[model samples]
Structure formats: structure tokens, C-alpha cells
Target: MTAQTGSDGPAAPEVSDRIGGRLLAMSLVLVLGTFMASLDSTIVNVGLPVLSVEFGASVTEVQWASTAYLLAVVAAAPTSGWLAERFGARRVWLAAVAVFLVGSLACALAWSTASLAAFRVLQGLGGGLLPPTGQALLARVAGKSRTGRIMSIVGVVPMLAPVLGPLAGGTLLEVADWPWLFLVNLPVGLVAMLLAAWLVPHVPAADRASRFDLRGAMLLSPGLAAVLFGLTDIGSAGRNTPIAVTALVAGAALLAAFLAHALRADRVPLVDPRLFRTPPLGAAVLALFVAAASVFGTMFLLPMYLQSGRGLSAWDAGLMLAPQGAGAVLGSLLVVKPLIDRVAPRTIVVTGFALIIAATVPLTQLAALSDGWLVAALLVRGLGTSMIASPVMTIVYTGVDPEWLPRASSVLSLVNYVGGAIGTAGLAVLLELRLTATGDVAASFSEAFWCVLGLCVLALAGALRLPKTAPSR
Candidate 1:
């Protein structure tokens, strides 16, 4: 966390309107990595059905492709901040990209779902570190004052994820084999890597001897996995079995122990608990926690709904999600870019969630809604999603010191994964239970929509604590 941003790294640079061409190039280059990582999170999901058939496995088994990647991403969190600072952001980022490329090639070559999951874990480790490290590097150059606007541009990746990911996955599958899904990242990634080697500036390590927090990493990673495993146990078993209870308890205890270690540490621990002391960062972090769930859980849910509820093909469902992606892109351009730098984050976030809540109202009636109605509702939700995410991320860099930016990104990214897992897993559990108990598919999904609504309300509560206005230049 004490890592230097530059020679005058600690001095806050003024936000210049005329952001130079060099900076913009750097930003775009960094965004390439962000796009790959973010896109991977959803694109592979569209291919799960294909994987199921190819491997002669159940959907439940094939799902580990996505889950294993997510879990690996979570596993990579604690180490990402350290990696960024230890080896320098450039080397670490390139290394991550290389690893991700390797994982992608391996996944393309995988023979079974089990092999794919294993390789994905390797890929997830790299994918997990890229966004946080990339953001930290960009923030180092962009300065806190410019974070809101620049971050808004970066928001395009996530905002467009709902659009490009599924659509691209669906479209690709139409013309090629499933292996192409993983292979596609190769060219794009190589271009990013080569450009990064040439264009991205290097920030050297501040402390070579900054001992890696092996203890903290151990506690945090396993702890998160255990909790997720417990949640999954409940989802699959349909009851709170002894294994679920034990896992839940053990995971809680480990997390508590890690928190105690972080709070009382003399040297900055991995994910220092004290980082929250920075104004509004805590609130922003909390908001992102639930926001991940609300956004991603819905992303997870809607595709399934279309495929299962409407009996559409995976590619069709992916195309059907285009409206939401379109709405998000428009919102980012029209709403977020202008307002994010001027308006209060609290207001923007609240408004975003409001749109989400409104959109979700239609989703609750998925049983009978036409594609037109569903698309319209999703479009609204997409707008809300951009409003919530970009503003909160804006607060992340602006609200904290440059030295803490990497760790801040790490913590925020970590929570986003955990929160998304909780939401997605919970929805899966509920959908499974309701489908079994009621034997009414639409009704079960309709009931799950209520949970998404609840997550939105919960996130809004945190957003209320965000700074009333954008951080001044």
C-alpha cells in the first residue's frame, strides 16, 4: 500500500480537461485487458450448454467452468495488490495477460469439463488480477481528480459486457466450434500485450522486500471459498445439512480471524481494514458489494430464464440480452459521462437503483411477459447498472490516496466477486427450491426476482452514505 505512483506520486495532479493523446492511448490499451477479463466472466456462460453436450456432462457439472474461474479470481485477489507493487504494474500485468493467454489456449484444447475447469482456474488467477492492477496503473497516470471521467470511459467494458459478451459468444458459436470461444481472446490479447510492452509506462516497485502476506492470503481465500461452498451446499441439498452448517461456521470463523489480523496489524496487511477510514471509500466499497450481486445475478438469471423459461437457444437468449446492453451503452454515454463528474454519487446511485427496481417489476411477471416487455425492462436495468457501477468506481480512486489505490481496487474487486457469488448462488438456490417445491418454472423465477429487488434496496442503503458530490478537482 505504500507503493509510489511516481517521483511526485503522492502529489495530487489536477484534472486536466485536455487529457493528452498519450494518456488516452494508455487508457485504451489498459482497457483491452479489462475488456478481456470482464468479457470472460459472461461469454463462457453462453457456451455452458455446448460444453455440456461436448463433454457428456450435466449442466451442473459443466457450470464448474464458470464457477472455477470465479473462484480462481477470488483466490487471486489478496495477491494482486502485492503483485502490482512488488514487480511493478507493467511486468505483473503482462505476466497476468500471458498467463491468461496460456489458460485460454489450454481451455481451447481441454478434452473434458473437468479439464476445462482446471485450466480455467489457471486463467481466472490471471483474469482476476488484471482489472485491479490495470486500474491502479491507469489511476497512477490519470490522477484522482480525473478519475470520475476516465473511469466513466472504463465503465464501457462492464456496461457493454451484457451486450457484447453473450452476443459475441452466441454469434461465434453459430459460425465456429466451442474452442473458438476461448481462442478468440488470443489475437486481441496478443495485440494488448504487444501494445502494452510498447505503450504502457512502467511504474517500478516501491519496496522489493514488502513481505507477501501469505498468512492473510491463506485465511481470506479459503474463507471465501468455504462460504461459497456452504451456500452451494444449501442450494444443491435443498436443506441446511450438517456439512453446510459446519462449512458456514468454519468460513465465518476464518474470516473473523483474518479481520482481527487486518485491523490490528502494525505493517499494512493485505486488504488493510483501516483503508475504510478513507472518506466514502467504505461506503462505496459496500455499495459495490451488493451492486455486483444485483447486476451479475441478473446477468446470470436472465439468460437462464430466456433459455429455460422461453425455450430459446443459448445464442438466441444472448441476442435477446442486447437491449439491456444497448441501454447500458447509451446510459454511459448520455447519462454517466456528463453527470458522474458533476452530480453526487449518492444521487446517481440512487437513481440507478430506482431504474433497476422499476425494471425488476416487469421481471417478476416473467411467466407471461413478451420479449418486447422483457427487453424494455432489461434496457432500464442496464441504465441503472451503469449509473451504479461507474459512480462507485469513480469514488474508489478519487476518495483514496494514490498509494492505497491498488489495494482499494483489490478490495473492491474482491467484494464484487464475493457479492456476485452470494447473489448468483442464492438465486440459483431459490430457483432450484421453488422449481422443485412448486413445479412451476415461471413462478419460481418470478419469486427470485423479488430477491434481486431486495439486493437493489440493500445496495441503495450503502449508496446513501457515498459523498454527496463528486470529489473536486
Candidate 2:
């Protein structure tokens, strides 16, 4: 099932066609953590206004609930690989689930907006750790042969979370209270933690991890957080404020330093700079980043467009977005994995971006589109997204040695997180400027779609650089 970049075909026998047995059981357990973490990222936005009124705070002040969690998630992501290597992926994942559970309950019991936001930080740390660590564990279990199918299982969670979050939040609010948003995580988290403890096997801690790239950590960690904070500031504060500018500059400098140090470091750095030069890995990282921006940025822009251009209620807009979830499911079931074993991942990724580009072109004519047309475009885009995420991620996991998978997952996850933030923030800023200049909402969205389309096109370029076939381990 291993495909060598140097070979004309796979170096091993065909991979299994489906997930089953204990691997399936363990995958479902990991999915619980992934679902909760990804779900909370979007779901809480639905409760922001309710929280503002409950605490008698300004909407902007209550907005910290989401912002704090986001920054916490970004900040905590870099530490996950280190933790997994030190304590084992299964242990780190279990600890993350427990921490997330406790944080969720604390969030439910929060007495003020400040408390809620603070509790969300604790929650976000766990949320940040869960996905990558769990992915490492599962990828180790599935190995090169079954990596694509594993991705189809796990990658689908985040895709569906955005579509489902608002609905879940709205339903809980209608039937219960704002606390239910956080409370919903309790049962799921508990079940996941317990099941994983009983069923998931431990990955041994690395002896090389003893070196612990303290220098790289110092530089890259804050560098990443600062960049994301700056981007978030621009989105929330609107335009390039002094804080955003300062953070961006400082973050860039720190990141540059980290890369410099990593390249020359005596020991294995936190993330090996060489990974970027490694085939399939570097290309996979770029592809995921662009895909994240296009998918998540559009996720941000569409809600506003739907509310303004189509004059749909938030609830209605959420429903319109539901097509993405359906398309994701359809693509996974009918297309992505089926061809993955039979076709080169390079072909899947290229075709995925092509679909994404074609899907995005419709949005450029925002003013002229009808509800049905928009839905179809989003559905196709979701399918394209599925096509990209599974193959691209599988390429990363399967191509690398299992010993290196933790850091690769960490690097790719960090890139994806920052890319999503950039997309959301960049679009927000561009849309604002466009609206101010044109005074036409439709025209502003059209301009923004052009940007999304441009990013997708750039991603496609990177996709083409990926090995025309998967490489052997």
C-alpha cells in the first residue's frame, strides 16, 4: 500500500477498502473528542448574543468568549506534539479530553462574561490538543495503507461541525439555556475519555523527545499566537489597528528567527525545517492551508452575505449552509476514498481544487445568484473540500515515518489553524473596505469572492507540486 515517489506504482499490496473492527471502535472514540473541539469553535458564536445580554455586557466585550477560546486554541496547538511525544498520544489525548470536560463544565457555570471567556481559554487549550494528538494516535493505528480511510473518518468531523454548530446551539437555546452549549460537551467528553481509556492503545514516548526544542518552542509558539492575535484583532477591530500591526510585525520576526534556529539546531528542532523541503509534506501543508482559508473564510463571509444580500435570518442562513455538510458526506461516500486506493492522491488533490475553483467562481457573481444556485455551488465546494482534505492529509501521515507523524500533524494543524484565521480576517477586512468604497453590498461580496478564488487558485498551484503519486514509507 506504500507508493514510492521514485517508483511507477505502489511498493506494497493494495490497502483495505473500509474501516472496521477495533480500529473502527477506537476511531469513533477519537471522533468524539474531535467533534466536541471543532463543534465548540463555531457553536459558541451562536450563543454570543445570549451571553452578552445575560451578563449585561457590550456585544464586543462578550465577543471575547470566542476570541479568547480561539487564541487559546492557536497557542496550545504547538505544544501538542511535544506533549504527545513526552507522554504518548493516547495519554495526551485522554488528558485533553478530561481537561476539555472540566473546562466545559466551568464554562457552563460561569457567572459573568469575563468568567465565561476565561473558562473558554482552559477549554480551548484542551480543544487545541485533542484533534492533532488524536489524529496521531489514529494515524499510527491505521498506518500507511489505511490512512486515507482514517482521514475520511476524522476530517469529516470539522467539515460538519460548522454546519451543525449553529443548529445545535439554537436548538439548545430554544429548549434550555446558554449553559447548554457548554453542557452538551459533558456527556460526549465523558464517554470519549472512558472509552478511549479502555480501548485505545498507547504509543511509546520518544527517547529523542528528551532534547525538547526549548529554543524553537520559545520562538515559534508566540510567533504563531501573535500572528493569529493580530489577524483576529484586524477582523474584530476592523482595519489595521496599532495592536494588529505591532503583533504582525513581531510575530513575523519571531517566526523568521525560529526557522533560522531550526535549520541550524544541533538536535532535532520542535518542527524540522527540512519537512518543508520534503516532497508531499511541504505540498500537503500548502494545500491544506489554502483549502482552510477558502473553506473557512467563505464560511465567515457567507453568513454575512446571506443575511445582507439574500435577507435571510441567521437560522435560515444556517440552513442554507447545511448543503456543505451534505456535500461533504456525499463526496466521502461516493468519491474520495473509492478513488484513493485506485488512483494517485495527486489526481484526487488536483481534481479537488479544480472543483473548489469551479465552485467558487459562482460566488463572484453574488448579486445575480439565486438560493438554489448558491446551495449547489456550496454543495459542490464541500465535495471538493472533502476531496482535498482526506488525500492531502493522508499523504502527510502515510508518507512520513510514524516516529515523525506527531510533528508533521502538528505542523499541518498549525498551518491550517492560522490559515483559517487569516482567511476569515482578511476577508473581513477586504469586505469592509469594499463596502466602504462601493456602497454596494453585492459588489463588495463579488470583490471578496475574487480574493477567495485567487487563494484557491494558488492552492491548486501547490497541489500540482505534490508528487504525482504517493511515496513509500
Candidate that scores best on TM-score: 2
Error of 2 at 413 (Å): 0.9
Worst 10 residues of 2 by lDDT: 4-13
Alpha-carbon RMSD to native, per candidate: 3.6, 5.4
Give the count of colliding residue pairs in each prediction.
Answer: 0, 3
Predicted structure with the largest lDDT when compared to the true one:
2
**Model 1, backbone clash pairs (residues 3+ apart or across chains), number:** 0
Model 2 misplaced regions, further than 4 Å: 1-18, 237-240, 470-473
Model 1 sits at a Cα RMSD from the real structure of: 3.6
Q: In terms of TM-score, how similar is model 2 to the real structure?
A: 0.93
TM-score of each: 0.91, 0.93
Question: How accurate locally, in lDDT, is each candidate?
Answer: 0.81, 0.83
Q: CA shift at 92, candidate 2, in angstroms?
A: 0.3
